[model samples]
Target: MGAMSHPHHPGELAAPDPVRLLAVRDTPLSLDEVFAAVGDDAAGGTALFVGTVRDHDGGADVAGLGYSAHPSAEAELRRVAQKVVDDFPVRALAAVHRVGELAVGDLAVVVAVSCPHRAEAFAACRRLIDDLKSEVPIWKHQNFADGTEEWVGA
Candidate 1:
């Protein structure tokens, strides 16, 4: 429908090139704010993933968690997010991961991927989170119900 559409590609198929990356902290994020920068009328599909701080992990009752990150974390996150979009044909991408002290059920991270089809959105979302966990400088500290706390991936 838009200039990005492929004439020969299936009607449901999406173009294999993405344009932007929007990433930030998880606290009180504005979905409208992040996607506003990346939205394209040409895009028909938008996929979003929100990672929340759960109450438990590995059978541990997590009461709270703390996270710390390098000062350059956001910049690096942007770079990596964009790279994933470029490598995967993501139409629009966003990633938000929080730092500092956080309570259980607080949002830990958020990632959104938009493309011409649902598959790219799903794929990109998965990869975005996977890459973030592996590559981003952000770290987490876990607090258990027993008042035990430990730094994770420091």
Candidate 2:
């Protein structure tokens, strides 16, 4: 899709593309989709981050995890993405967090940032995921192999 255009007053250029994509969905997340959203001719580098469910956490055997998001989660994601764009020299950006049950190795989140250089792209991508994890209202319910369950990042 083309970059969205916003209304601008006279003598003002159009606003730069802030975030190419931002979403919270119950279905599995896709790295390709996120990467494609940030594809820009002006960008010399693109950084991508994919977070997946691991088999273990804190030395405990994790069987799987179920992600749940508050009603404001999507909005919070957009807020976080926009912050990264504003703080960095980002040409384009995208972020998606997955909800619903997921097995081990399944993707939990995917984020991408494109910039004029590798350093900025990497920094912006890192900031996007870090802020999203810290600010977004998402919880993880982990199922352990030992027949126990725990809630994390609530």
Candidate 3:
């Protein structure tokens, strides 16, 4: 048989696209912007995640860090967000990642998701952040206090 197709059940409507914002920017990330992007009146709950640059990693004191992204990074982020929306009853979704040099405690990424219930919103938000970290073509260059450096997720 040729390619098999799965069809929607009778009276079942397809889900509307819920992704509102997706960006990889060289400026600071704003939690308020991300949270606002996912605002949905029909949603019973909204979950948000913020990733920040820390002072230490792998037993080393971090001095600072910088992030760089490939040209395709934004497209890959869209793919990851769409996957989350397809798996959950997402009413709205938004994600933003920061590039360029960043100091400790600076926001690295922010993601938010809204759904009909709290659990779905939380789960979808978590999945969106985790997948964005692992699957996107963004790399980090971390500098340590000891004059050493390392690259992660390159």
Give the best candidate by lDDT: 3
What does candidate 3's lDDT look like per residue over 49-116, in tens digits? Answer: 99999999999999999999999999999999999988888889999999999999999999999888
State, as a TM-score between 0 and 1, how close model 3 is to the true structure: 0.90
Spell out the clash pairs found in candidate 1.
Answer: none
Pairs that collide in candidate 2 are none
Highest TM-score among the candidates is held by which one? 3
Q: Determine the C-alpha RMSD for candidate 1 after optimal superposition of all C-alphas.
A: 4.0
**lDDT computed for candidate 1:** 0.72
TM-score of 2: 0.89
Off by over 4 Å in 3: 1-15
Spell out the clash pairs found in candidate 3: none
Ranking 1 against 3 by TM-score, winner: 3
Residue-wise lDDT of candidate 1 within 1-154, one digit each (tens)?
5677565544233344453554545466555655664576555667777777889888989998888888888878877787776666555677777777888777777677776667766777788888888888888889899888877777
Query: Which of candidates 2 and 3 is the stronger one according to TM-score?
Result: 3
